[model samples]
Target: MATSRALAQAPPAPARRGQHPGIALTVIAATQLMVVLDITIVNIALPHIQQALNFNTTDLSWVINAYTLTFGGLLLLGGRTGDILGRRRVFIAGVLVFALASLLAGVAQSSAWLLAARSLQGLGGAIASPTALALIATNFREGPERNRAFGVFSAVAGAGGAIGLLLGGMLTSWLSWRWVFFVNVPIGIAIALLAPLYINESERHPGRFDLVGAFTATVGMVSLVFGFIRAAEHGWTDSVTLLSFSLAVVLLAAFVLNERRAPQPITPLHLLRDRNRSGAYGLMLCVAAAMFSIFFFVTLFVQDILGFSPLRAGFAFLPISVAIIAAAQFAARNQVRYGPKPFLVTGSLLVLGGVVWAAQTGITTTYVGGVLGPTLLFGLGMGSIFVPVMLTAVSHVAPHETGAATGMLNTTQQVGGSLGLSILVTVYGTASRNEARQQLGAFLHQATPQQLVEFRATGRLPAPYSSQVLVHGISSAFQMGLVFAALAVLIAVFVIKVRPAPAPVSPSGEGA
Candidate 1:
């Protein structure tokens, strides 16, 4: 109970001032970067992995999904575990496990082996990530020092996707796709070694762990995500799709009901009782869904349509990475003064605008004119939105629940992104197929074998006409993103309410 009480208390004052704080911050930030980057690092390598392992198309996505589902699902448990066990102990253990899993994945010769490794990696990440964040929370005071640290933290979080893409491209291009996982080994080892030396362990909570809540939530989310992803590839009306949805409904319903009864629930039911926190979670869900789906589709468009080399496609996202980091830094500094409402509202609106711009892109449209502007806007908007939303989510929570609060925020982001994107895949499929049907309508009756072949290759009518429909399908998917962003803005303005106050100095001195 004392450990739990300690968790509920404000972080202890920094020990032995001077340069040690800076070193500690750097180490934590680097570890955070590695964990975040893993979310997307395997994306660019998917095709290569599939080729190497001879995996079926449907099974290929599992390589990525396995990690995300486990990571998101187990986050609460991991966070709570850190409260029970020492944060530094859990963090170091997680790093070692993650590194081992990476090695397993890199050396895997079969799809099954690789998938197993990915799942293990997810478990490691789930444990490590929350502990790392909590360690940061405990180590730094909640003023300028913490704020600056959070800024650097947010930057890494935002930039990780781009870094993953870049790294994946390089690994897949110059060496082997497996190198993507292989590279994590040494970095992880270094971090693991430094963690104990640099980071002090948090006081451990001796209270009962919420195993029941953890099981229900994890299984429920995994089932729910699996069902949605299945629906995307298979028709929504398929028997498997129906069963998946039905199972998800039952499991998640059970999770909710079970949580209501559990003592020290992994995700405290009270967290959702707050309207502001609820709105933050909703905002995260909607925005992440739109943003991540865009990444998925845009990757395909660049590679298949624009014929960009892997590395070039990776680098193309650099502007977005830059815009996001810059905007996040600005938002973190001014959030307290402006209040999160304005930033959330403006950010979502900008995201909507970006989605609209992206919707208008065509095969003939240059990346500069078509993708760049929207990407910039989307990045800037997301950068502004996430920091404040994250801050707001935890602002009013008691200290013991900080891990739970952070886990809930991350869970919403990860699960929402996965589930939302799966749903959007259906939108994309519908748009593409309908366009293909329209384009090939006349040719269906009078087509030669060659003409039909050509039509199939482009998935549309020939030449000038085909480009319009192909672009239209892509645009339609982006239009869906626009709608989601618009909805997020409305929610942020109307739903998320926080009292106005002057901005605080960032925890680190950079923002001050």
Candidate 2:
């Protein structure tokens, strides 16, 4: 109780003035961009990495899953660390660790070495991302200035995946795929050096670290994520997958019990007690689930199915990035006036429409008709959703709880992406197998015995037949994406209910 009172009374660091403020904002934004995009940057490089490391198809997913699982799992602890220690100290430590991990990842020789490095990178990201957002709340006054700052941050957050696709493709094409990891070294180093000069450290709360709570929560999330990943590759009934799920449930239950009793909990359960904030978190989860699927399946569609070069595939996402930036900026300017509900509802509907339209893609569909249109719609919808949802997630929260709130928001996104992708992959696999079986049956009926013998020997489908089956699988995944988007829409309409923020008063004591 003493610690909680002290935390509530702790003052935010004064905002820096003039040119130094811009530099500080730049440092924060740059760190955020690096952390967020790392989630997807390695995606484009996966094939190259697999070939170089002699990874079987099943093992290759660990490269992505390892990072996401640790990053998502540890975020709550990272947020509490920032609150208990100095935000600046933890932020710098995270950047340094990230840079070192990136260096190790770039030079890794074996699959295990790379996975280890990637897990460290996720740890670094988990520490850095929540603290970075909390810094914005600490540094900026809560009004237009903060809204504009969040606009830039939100835009980067929304567009980072698309940007990663482009950046990864360029790096993988011009240089080696290793450059994708190596590229972070220079950026992380610069952020670490510049942050101290520009960014102010927040007041640290006096408390004990919730080590037990942290352990259970992190392990629980990891198990749950692993279970989903395993289910995607193996059948849901596989013993290992079932065991992972069972362990996850047990560990997570223990984590909840621990948090309930811990004097200083990693996750402050009270944060979720507010209806609007909880709704915001839920909406982000659903939106992220849909958004991640869009990126994953679209990347696969453009690259594997369309035979796009790495550079071309990266450029393919440029439109979506641009649209997100523009939409986020617009939301930044107007959300205070109109409130978040309209934007949330409309944005979610756009996402649903875009994903449903994307489900119409076929083997013969053109990029302009099939991919580009849906991409634009998704971009617009996502941009609108990101800014408003971010605002609601932190709305009306006490000053001390800012880091935890933002951390929870980010955790939902990372976990949702991992979970959504796993589910979609499962859907895709089942759909593909069924489609292939049907196609094989039709082919067997048409073919002569000698033709059947040749076909069986080759074990391959000719040309468009194989492409058609794959596209069908991708489309089925998009249909699942529609379900996610629709859930977000329902949450927005039914769950979220926040009043508009009051206009800021000027120095003259009148509303601006």
Residue 361 displacement (Å), model 2: 1.8
Instruction: Show where candidate 1 strays beyond 4 Å.
Output: 1-19, 442-470, 500-512
Estimate the TM-score of every prediction.
0.91, 0.94
- Candidate-wise lDDT, in order: 0.80, 0.87
True lDDT of residue 19, candidate 2: 46
Off by over 4 Å in 2: 1-19, 446-458, 507-509
Q: What value of lDDT does candidate 1 attain over all alpha carbons?
A: 0.80
Clashes of each: 12, 0
**Candidate 1 lDDT tens digits, 171-284:** 889999989999989999998877766676676655567777777788878877777777656777889878877887887888888778877778888999999999999999
Which candidate should be chosen as best, given TM-score against the real structure?
A: 2
